[model samples]
Target: EEKIPGVYGIDTRALTKLLREKGSLLGKITFEGGEDIEFHDPNQENLIAKVSTKEIVEYGSGDKTVVLVDCGTKYNIIRCLLRLGVKVVFVPWDYDFTQMEYDGLFISNGPGSPEFAEITVEHIRKAMEIGKPICGICMGNQLLCKAAGAKVYKLKYGHRSHNQPVRLVGTEKCYITSQNHGFAVDNSTIPSEWEPHFINMNDGTNEGIRHKTKPFFSAQFHPEASSGPKDTEFIFEEFVNLL
Candidate 1:
């Protein structure tokens, strides 16, 4: 593990920890075209084999929850998920795949204007159409609203601080949250199929929402906050239960 201020790098040990192997490699490396040994040592320089894994480049996962992310937004949420025993997969959220097979999906926070993410939106739509248990925060939340036929509107002044207060709606409980988004789900554009789950008590803007029927939900705040309050971190618990 290498950390230099805001940038970090991953090496082979990180890969091992991510594979959840107690210093053990699972299965065997197999080559394409089907004519080779199923197992071998990594030291074989003469081996003619290559295997492709549906790798989680940025996020970490357990043996179960296969979480996904919107590229670079996977940092803090991944740490929380891993602590909760989840197997995460983080890749550029805009990749096009005809079908996806995963136990669960988690979209992480990222910077930028959410409306410029058309490709990412399409991928999210496909994931939603597949109907797997999904959770999203920040940009992930915005994408969820977009996938569910809700409109995303930019705030005149975005919430980009860590000390924002988010009300859970039904309760007077207010969680001090970490947030960084200039856009929010237009409450009026939300379809009846979805129910607002959390709200920003300060402005009454939509903060979190869940599907009325499907196992899809999102939050506009960052719950997996590192170096901040973990008050809203229970969202990961909710995800584990939902999945």
Candidate 2:
């Protein structure tokens, strides 16, 4: 148990059913004679700032260099890129990477609202101006959409499972992807130059988006999988090839 503190006597199965049916909820736990604590809503906090690296970190020694915005990134993303032999320059969520030289710009997946990373959105917009290859995953998708002038909204219950089905924009080809997001990009608000690239088959939410003519794209699902399916691992190769 790691000796961690926990509240007991609650029916976890019923709680799970309630969350599934009523969407996400904010609650606080207390015990008799314990000091009262205010309810905490994680979504309202800048979780990226808490999880992102405070200093720049470099990994691998490949020819192609990738500037990865560490908005609470998963290590597997670096592992996947390293496997493809690309040099990854990891930076914090708000660090400016436009001045530095890199073949591509990667916005890493994160937690919380995209509004907290407005600086990141601005940086991505500037990077887009230079036409550098850009790719993002999960929360990365929301930030990318915001950078492109699209709207992002919180999901009801959110896609927090390993087996989420997403279909290509105009094709029947579908891939089972790993997802854990509480927000999604609004496809209708996407600019004309950018189109919805993928659609969630379950809820018809925007799963991904891409520029019409530029090498900019993002996915709301994890291609790295980590603890989930590997059906979308090809996404990494596709982004790397662009670089």
Candidate 3:
């Protein structure tokens, strides 16, 4: 049984259509005799701080070490890296990871706007100069863009499915992906030194970005999709290759 209170029997299809047309809306589901409540917008909150680990955590023991900046990261992300024989040093969202010795840096997916994680972005800027291989996923992608001076904005309704199509930049190849983010990087605002790595086929939005000549890149989708397509699992390999 569902633990949370819920009101059912509504036309979910109509609601989905309305959301598609009107974008993300804030609303409260009220049951009979329930008091009216204000709809809170989670986007304005620093959800990363709330969900990120409070202290440093390490997993596995491998020669190649990866400092994973946890911003509400999925367990599958760590599992994927650990599968690659990477010793993972999981840290908090705002932790200063630049000081730690590691072969690669990874920014994991998280919730809410990238603005709240400015501290993490600052650390990323430092990591970028350090020249260690770096990879980011979802909100991590947004933070990397922010570190590079690119702008990020909230998406309309957001991408939340396993079948989203993405095309490689400057190539004809396309991959079906799993995604669940409500913000996107503004390609037009992306700096000259960095270029788009992937593009969303449906909306033509930037799905990924990479530095011109550095081992720095990020994807706005989940490559460690346990229940979704395996096409992008190669992404973890690509990141490991950088290490």
Candidate 4:
């Protein structure tokens, strides 16, 4: 009798090393009998449509209304916003929310490459046209960069740990942060109107960006820190203050 083949285990340590050296790439797994199956790259598709909230969802009853572009937003992002005494209205990633009255615009975290979320990028560009205070997290950061004419690229091994350290730009202050993403904004591509706000201490990668005189900013880390440290929880407070 022939034995069936299956994965016994994965060498995560070696995989991590390889990813670090080669950056993120498109690949696939196949069984011996399924060797002819094709591998499709999810990054090339419109990921926002699959991940965004179809219907508008509201939370909290604070005076300020924050229009949250739902790109598979994490629950903690809403939780933190509610805790800040602000009203959150979660809209689809491709929704044209310019007609809606709001105090701020927030872009949420999600999966796949930010380039695939072209509609969300356009919405952000519209928000910028209206001069709304904007804040983003995780994938949100990359989308904001795209809206600002900046470029994003896949990171080698990315920042996917809880205790990643990030230092505030032009400051000696460092904060332990929670991160989970495979792409990063290219620091060299940021326009003159914006500046690098935070940097990863371990690898010197761009961790955040901020507009020079506009109330626009974004972080690659999860400041809400659902299952991680709260060292950067003040980021939420800062966003609220911007409004």
Top-TM-score structure, candidate number? 3
User: How much is 8 displaced in model 2, in angstroms?
Assistant: 5.2
lDDT (CA) for every model shown? 0.72, 0.92, 0.93, 0.90
lDDT of 4: 0.90
What range of 10 consecutive residues in model 1 has the weakest lDDT sum? 44-53
Clashing pairs in 1: 60-88, 61-86, 61-87, 61-88, 62-86, 62-87
Q: How do the residues 1-243 of candidate 4 rate in per-residue lDDT, one tens digit apiece?
A: 577655657898998788778876666667766557777878677766897888998998999999998998989999999999999999998889888999999999998888778887888998999998999999899999999999998887678899999999999999999999989999999999999999999999999899999999999999988899999889889999988
Task: TM-score for candidate 4, please give it.
Answer: 0.89
Model 2, 46-150: lDDT tens digits are 999999999999999999999999998999999999999999999999999999999999999988888899999999999999998999899889999999999
How many clashes in candidate 2?
Answer: 0
Top lDDT prediction, candidate number: 3
Which residue pairs in candidate 2 collide? none
Question: What are the per-residue Cα lDDT tens digits for candidate 1 across 1-243?
Answer: 565334236476777676554423335545459788756443332111121123436445466756465445646666777887877666555655425556888776766656656676787788887888888788788877887889988675577788988888678888998887767898998999888888987788999889988888888987887756779888888887777
Worst 10-residue lDDT window for candidate 3 reads 30-39
TM per candidate comes to 0.72, 0.93, 0.94, 0.89
Ranking by TM-score: 3, 2, 4, 1
CA lDDT, candidate 1, residue 157 = 55
Worst 10 residues of 4 by lDDT: 26-35
Q: lDDT per residue, candidate 3, 57-114, as tens digits?
A: 9999999999999999999999999999989999999999888999999999998888
